[model samples]
Target: MKEAGATRTMKRAVNIRIESKQAEQTQTQQAKGELYEKNGAYYLRYAEPDGEMGQTTATVKWDETHIKVIRHGDVQSDLTFRSGVRTTGGFTLPQGRLEMEMYTHGIDRKLNEGLGSLAWSYDMYTGGAHVGRIRLRLMIEEDRSE
Candidate 1:
């Protein structure tokens, strides 16, 4: 992936796994993508598998204190997580609309130029009712096979 005016953009292999346990089922979404760095932050981009309309593009931007994820396609969403704080983001998706408040309680990350990893967890609520606990993990490695 390449971005205009970016300090650096490197081809990378990204493994992203998102797990959410609501009720009794644990749903997981995994994908491979690209990674790059700009200024002092890192941005990872990936394409969701082609659906009936085509593929959805998603980008994850993170730094030392916060993580923001944006997805665009048939549906659009922007979610944010701040270190050890409560952050709220809501958007409509193909599954439905999810507009809730989430409290992040866990955050662990190690990022650099060549490789990086981030793990975070939070509990979501809707109308004061416990929604579910969600965890997201990312593993990034620079692609040097070229």
Candidate 2:
């Protein structure tokens, strides 16, 4: 895969799987999104279903050491992650929006031969109370049907 940028007219199909656990409750979600790379950063844009909370569009941006995730539409959030550093953002729920803190443990990224994977884990806190740890795995593959 090209590292700098994707072709302007090309859009690759990406598959995303996410598992989130809070307290004793766990949820798993899978979706298809569009993948594009620009200026050395890769982006994934997808829609998220929240049942009673409605739906939202999510955009994820990542480079070598940092990742930023944002959601819009029905819910909103902006979270950033980097290993060994704490980042702050906002999380929106049906009840309300709250400030959030995330401390990343590790991030592993690999992209080659039209396949890409990113793995990361982080600790989350809200209002000085520990929420839970989260692990995320993302995989992307080029759609070369053209």
Candidate 3:
């Protein structure tokens, strides 16, 4: 019984990791170009090698511990993607938030386009909660020119 319980717990943990990775991949494929905010709108621009360009709009929600964003637009051909990140570790001091950013580009599978990067940060709290905020960013650019 004890072994079975441990196995169940491990399975759940593995499932969470798989889900998180899937979410991260979805975000990476859908995020492209530069991010900007104007007035009350958030905008992103994506350019394809076929001379096609796209723009997206969405809202971002931020709290002391997490940041959630939802964007919708015709940034790609017949495809739409959504992504988010949440903090699991670290101390929450001074009420900080986690931020995640991702970017992607389509390129030929045999060539290199120099379009992959990731950035993450954690903000530690001053209180005794032993909690902190986590942030992650990822970008990928592919060469679509054949």
Q: How far off is residue 39 in model 1, in Å?
A: 2.5
Distance (Å) between predicted and true CA of 137, model 2? 1.0
**TM value for model 3:** 0.22
Model 2 CA deviation exceeding 4 Å by range: 1-9, 21-26, 143-146
Off by over 4 Å in 1: 1-30, 49-54, 94-96, 144-146
Q: Give the per-residue lDDT of model 2 (tens digit) for 1-146.
A: 34434434355786766666656777777777887767667788888844654688989888777999999877889999999999999978777899999999998777652257777889999999988888877766654544
Please state the error at residue 78 of candidate 3 in Å. 34
Cα lDDT tens digits, model 1, 34-97, are 7777776778888864364245788888766778888888757788888678887776767788
Cα RMSDs of all predictions?
A: 5.1, 3.2, 19.4
Q: Rank the candidates by TM-score, best first.
A: 2, 1, 3
What tens-digit string does per-residue lDDT give for candidate 3 at 1-146?
01111112110100000011332242223433443333322223333322232344433322222233444443311211222332232211234433322222211111112123323343333233433343444343432432
How does residue 125 of candidate 1 score in lDDT? 78
Q: Looking at candidate 3, what is the lDDT of residue 126?
A: 28
Question: Candidate 2 local accuracy as lDDT?
Answer: 0.77
Question: How does candidate 1 fare on TM-score?
Answer: 0.74
Question: Model 3: runs farther than 4 Å from truth?
Answer: 1-29, 35-114, 124-131, 143-146
